[model samples]
Target: MSAAFFSATYGEARQRFLEAATRAGAAVGHHVHPLTGAAGEEIGTDTALLGPADAGKLFIVSSGTHGPEGFSGSACQLALLNDELARRAADRGIALLLIHAVNPFGFSHLKRTNEDNIDLNRNFNDFATPYPDNPVYEQIHDLLVPAAWPPSADNEERLNAAMARLAGQRNPGVSSGQDKHPDGLFYCGTAPAWSNRTIRSILRAHGTTRRHIAWIDVHTGLGPYGHGEKIFGRHSEETTRRAKAWWGSDLIVSTATESVSPRTVGHITGCAPEECPDAAITPTTLEYGTVPNPVVRRALRGEAWLAGHPDAPATLVREIRQAVRDAFYVDADDWKGMILGQFRSQALQTINGLAAEE
Candidate 1:
């Protein structure tokens, strides 16, 4: 059962992913990160390639773009590695590429972003041009990440007020990439981070080889419990419509225009087309919701605040990290079962869609 696949920590999850991929006969490879994990253990992005190496259509399934959320993604990827998935994908002449732990540092440290304190999803923009700016994030930046571990009453009030104001304007969270604030909650890095570079390299290598590509990046911390939300941003409506055709009509598609998730700049899915221009790419995120928005935001703020305050108490640090991790992942058998079932259904749909293209 998938209950056995859910891991308590990053190291265990990575180990299990590798073992399952290898046992299932995937061609395993890895890109080692330069930095070490919190436990002084090494971390890296692992890739498991199934089906023909030179297949014209490739379906890339990724996990851990948000670090702590990788646990569920990793589990799904592992669960999806049985002989049946491999055979079905092969029958469609589709190659399945499982990229596990793209943000290993965050996954290992139980944080949302990478070691650079940059959101991996937001760090994928073109550096040659001017990065996107959000004045709203700047105005409420300080209030978002408080000076203390457990924010003071006044700090809470100010933040709550700002959130309400932002909400009244139809949005509040400042997730659009901000290069000015390095220590902020949703700090988009000033330059390409390691994970950004690594993913691009992957797309160029594998994506360029394929005539058509379908990518599903696993995520959590939004939507109903165990439900997988299909999220898209920074793309045209044509792309969204085509994605619906490829994935399914029932898929919940949310763009920056009307998403509960803030409108953002650089996103990982953009890599397939940008890096491999000749390939027709279909990409979207599988975001599984855990807790409600307020609870998740509080957990994120707590972790973001703790990032600035290293002197915070040990107990508080543990609690905050755990809370944020929990926000993205629900460590229960039923939740795991729900995720695995949906992943399998979506993956089969992608394979069938690719076969139609063939």
Candidate 2:
């Protein structure tokens, strides 16, 4: 059953991934995270590679760039490992790289950002240059992350009113990314996060020699429930045309007017060109929807509040964290089935596209 491949905790998920990698005869490796898990268990970003190391084509699937969102991504990776996809890729001489828990701290602790509260998705820019500005994010920062866990009714009313007036003006900072506020939502750090560095290193090692590479960075909590919205990972015309040809017309270019995701800078996939300059890359984010947009926003705000107020009551703490989890993961049998089914289909399409030239 699809539910069988899913796990209840990050520790359990990591263990299952390692065991499955061994069972599949994958070349396994680990980059240990500095912090322990929520249960005080060890934490790390694990990798498993199937097929020849020097394969000309590479297929990379990564999970947990947003912490709890890893639940669906991890399940998809686990399902792939146990399936016949590996053999098919190996037959085509395509190396399948499974990167588990790119943000181990967030994955283990149930927070979307890393230990430093940096949104790893927004933390992959070149640090030598000046960081991007988000003045609109500055305007709504106080409303988005109020002083209290559950903000007063008055605060909510004013925030809602402001949002209504500013509708279409810009995203409320959560999606656009920011650097001014360290504890704010979607905070892109002033420097490269460890997760950022580690993932880039992984790509440099496995992708440098590849002629063609396709990366699927699995995500959750956008679009309709249980539907995997394929967002083209890059903005360039060449990559955009190739992606549409491979993933079909259903693919959503994030820069489009009707896209679910906003056009944000410094995505995890943004590092690909710099690291794997020689390879032709087709990247996408397979985002599965869990809850509605408002619900997801509330959950994120509550979690951000909890981060600043660790002394919160245990009951309140549990409530906030549970909301965060539900926003990213729908732990039902049907949802698991949908996630696996969509991911599997995309994987097959990617494999076909990569093997077409061969």
Candidate 3:
């Protein structure tokens, strides 16, 4: 399946994924013209179905919430649909839902955030939480997005220092600590963005009736190179134990271990489970590794540059866009192989896990 879609762009990968899902006899639903992109592209996110609509157990795999990271997830979903797994899903009475490019605007424009620069992951918390203020983010906001095209050396130093301070905090709660960077990385939005709202709505519509649900929101740009960390949706002992017993060796609970992800605020799956309390929702993020964290931060700097300077040179814009893509996904055969293998393994494990529950 990786051979079929080699080094494809986000749009290309998404289209191929949808085609494969349809070929596998999956019903498709499109959120047509739901949002517009920065370049005014009519971006529509689509959800493909592979098994029965009302199966007892539902396996939901979504990609591209962060936009550029969708390439790898999209490819993995397409590969799984093309493989024998889709047939197995149908046979086992497990409903397989493949959501491609949840953030179509970011995917098309090669940006991680949406048109309004809202990080969808951070926009999922309840409004009652008051959008947890980030004073640190506010302080470094200007440094991250400079008035000039490319940031100066001093600006880089200041940004690096702030990131170092934030990253060094060992406490889980500290990661989501308030910062004053309105235009910096990990900027939680002023309010719930369109993507967050749409996902919550989808969960309410599709996820409410399921007896058991296993959601794997695909992501990238963290952890060891090429490794996919299975981050649990919430920090619960029972859920962690269940994930370990069900998914076995592939599972990496971020709440339990400090290896992959630190506990943070505003997760998409976390909100989904909260919204659909009736269902036994087991949300796990399949985060594939790309560059190192520092390198990823640098790539994000480039993204900020592009976002802050709309009138930048064409060459710089192209370079920044490509850099952001490369940061999350390496266009190599081995990396693609890892992506497909990890996703397939986790998907099967999740299906088996749900079956065990039943």
Candidate 4:
């Protein structure tokens, strides 16, 4: 199917995906919560699950955990159900679970963070584990968030200096400028935000008692545009080997390696393995690249400016919204094709891996 045919707004995509799953004879479950955004938009996080309620092995494909990033993930999910691949998986006795719009407020507003401006991915630390503090983020936080809109050239220079010093062609697993500007980009959040809480609730609600669990949390930004990097959820050699064997060694990218991928910090995977301890949780992220990271960072900066400057001109807001969308979605047939094709292939690999294990 064409990507254009699958394109949908967050709510529309969720509705269509659920409908397709139901029509395919898959059981559905929903968790809804109300959220009032900074723009006064009443958005709700609606999570839907497909497949058997108590299946031994569950293959989870989740989208919109980062809001706007849902465009690709949602399309991939819808395409899987609408395509013949879903039937094949079902016939093999594999349960497919689609978690749509994990962060609805972010998806609705085209912002990366939830209504509370919290990066849900970074909000998943075990409460008992001390929240890792990024002291470097404190030093340059003010530079990232200027008092004026459209930061001055000097501000950009300062940001470049900070990036050069800390990130230096590599994300050091700690963001610079977090302590001073908690509201700025890469802000992990003061604590577990609503989106994080909601996802945890979903995991507890649907993830218990499963024998094997495979998760593909879709994301965009950070790597070569249009390619999906399969990042491992755990560092164990056994899990890494399993991921490579299942997804093809060439397709899997390890954060431990300096290859084309960058290191991640405070990721959601930390919780998945523990969430279903009884299950051999083989969690990995299928991160489809959008624009360059620097460009993405700049777009995020624009979003932050818009969120703060609510009175900004309508034209500027629209431009920023488009930029945000282009940064992730890349409205092109080839890009969407690559995303969907890889998504289906990986989903099948996961299902087959579980069935083989059985």
Candidate 5:
């Protein structure tokens, strides 16, 4: 019954999410993005609120900030929505909020970035203050985003070697966030993005005066196959200590820790806690691994290259798009089942933890 909830396209996923939310007796709202879908349909991020309107404890799950990665996130969201997950949360006196397709434009366009070609995860920064300067990303920017798709053997080796250097002993500097290079991977925007504004708005409304809040931003790529890494971040030591207590010792600290992925600059989940002053917030990312770093880098580059050449041959476009999708989302049933299982466990854990706090 749950497996059928996974959809092949953004349109299908959105429809399933809406239907499941409706069935779960949730009030849903759409923040329309200023972009059109592939088939001329409207593009927007949808939010579903299930449970008491003014519930002090809230559990939020957001998907698709990276676009294609939304597939896994959306599926897990549907599975929970169609099942008894929300009811259980409500029983615990918690409101379950599901924000679907934060970057609807990217989800529809087959690009990881939004319509402005900005990475939503990396776009969370103070405009008054300067964006983080990633010297490493700048040094290898051209190599990452080439004019040609599937660079020649010589170019591929060079780019790989440069990337290898970035993946140092600690694997620290290999991030996609860079503000200077807009056309490159991990491009942080100069201004707040539509998704950023919309998400912040939701957080401000739903997060205010909440006694406890647990947020899970779903993602894929990085770590062992089919494993969900509970990567967390916080503003201070007290918050960090409380979060560790809430999420348990197994959770990975996104910063000041060793991990397969690089430390992000402006993660959206990390910023949510700041919006909720009185709430004891625990924010983390459910990052499921799909493939190795090399494979993932190749797919990201291919997608970026494909974006650069919209006038390219049909066959080439088709090839890159499929590669990018497979890199982010595994089509196998066993893989998706693993995701759903973890999602269920985590959702339950969140409810238990929040309920205890209350």
Candidate 6:
């Protein structure tokens, strides 16, 4: 059942994934994280590979890029393994790689960002060049991360006004990617984050020789409930056309008016083009909507406050933690079903697309 593929905690989800991969006869590799999980459980990025090491085509489904959002992505990956989708893809001469828990710290701690509070999606930019500046984010940093969990009404009003100004902007300062404020929302790190380097390393290891690579990075906290928004963010006209052809007209170009996400810099999917320069890269983020924008914003603000103030009351800490988790993961049977159905369709689409003639 779909519900069985999902789990309440990251540890349980990891265990289920490892077991499922084993049962599927996959070659597994674990990239252990230096930090421990919220419950003190071991956390790491796990990969299950199916198909020849020299396979020219690669299909990747990655879960847990946004911490608790991993619950849905993990479920999807588990469903794929359990349903023999991996085996099927391998049989078709396409390598199927299930990358579990790309951001294990956030996955285990229920935080959207990683251990360093860096948003992994926004942490993939080149450090040698000048970083992207967000003057608007700088102005609203104080308003976004207040000293208290329940921020003052004055702060809320000011923050809301700031958000209102950014309503239709291509890159909303808050979520776009920032480096000035370490404790602020969506802090793109000053340098390559551990997960950023890890992802690059993984890509170089498995994808350097591949002629074609398709990546489906799963995320949450945007759009309508249970809807998986297919987001493509690359700039190349050629790859963009290929992505459109594969994912269809419903695919949302991040820079387009139809996209629910921001036109942010430093996307994780960008790593593929850099790591595997010769491969034809087709990438999309499957962003599942769990809650409304305001609720998600509130949860992120509260969680950021909690991160800065470690001495807060236990009850308040629990409340903020649960809020952050809930904002990303909807722990209901119906939601799981929606996730499974949509994810399965996309997975099959990717397999068939890669299997098609050039």
Superposing every Cα of model 1 onto the true structure, what RMSD results? 1.9
> lDDT, candidate 5, residue 2?
46
**For model 1, how many clashes?**
1
**What ordering of candidates by TM-score runs from best to worst?**
6, 2, 5, 1, 3, 4
**Per-residue lDDT of 332 in model 6:** 90
Q: At residue 266, what lDDT does model 1 achieve?
A: 79
What overall lDDT, based on C-alpha atoms, would model 1 receive against the true structure? 0.83
Ranked by lDDT, top first:
2, 6, 1, 5, 3, 4
lDDT of 5 by residue, 1-358 (tens): 4467678999999998998898888999888887798678888999899988878889999999888899988998898887776898888789999999989987877777788778888888877888777787877778877878777888888888887776663323647377887677887789989889999998897788688888899999888899999887635787677667777788887664565557677788766766887887788899999988789888888877766677999898878878878888888888888889888888888888888785
Error of 3 at 201 (Å): 2.4
lDDT tens string, model 2, 51-130? 98889999999999999999888999999999998899999889999999999989888899888888888888878876
Q: Clashing pairs in model 1?
A: 222-289
When 3 and 4 are scored with lDDT, the better candidate is 3
- Model 2 poorest ten-residue lDDT run: 165-174
Question: Cα lDDT of all candidates, in order?
Answer: 0.83, 0.88, 0.75, 0.72, 0.82, 0.88
Off by over 4 Å in 6: none
Q: Can you give the lDDT of residue 76 in candidate 1? A: 83
Per candidate, the number of residue pairs that clash is 1, 0, 14, 3, 1, 0
Task: Please report, as a residue range, the 10-residue window in candidate 3 with the lowest summed lDDT.
Answer: 170-179
Which ranges in model 3 have alpha carbons more than 4 Å from their true place? 1-3, 34-41, 135-142, 170-181
- Model 1, 75-191: lDDT tens per residue? 888888864977789777889999999999999999998887889888888889887667778878888787776778998898888877777342334666678877887787888
Query: In angstroms, what RMSD does candidate 6 have relative to the true structure?
Result: 1.3
The deviation in Å at residue 297 for candidate 1 is 1.3
TM-score of 6: 0.97
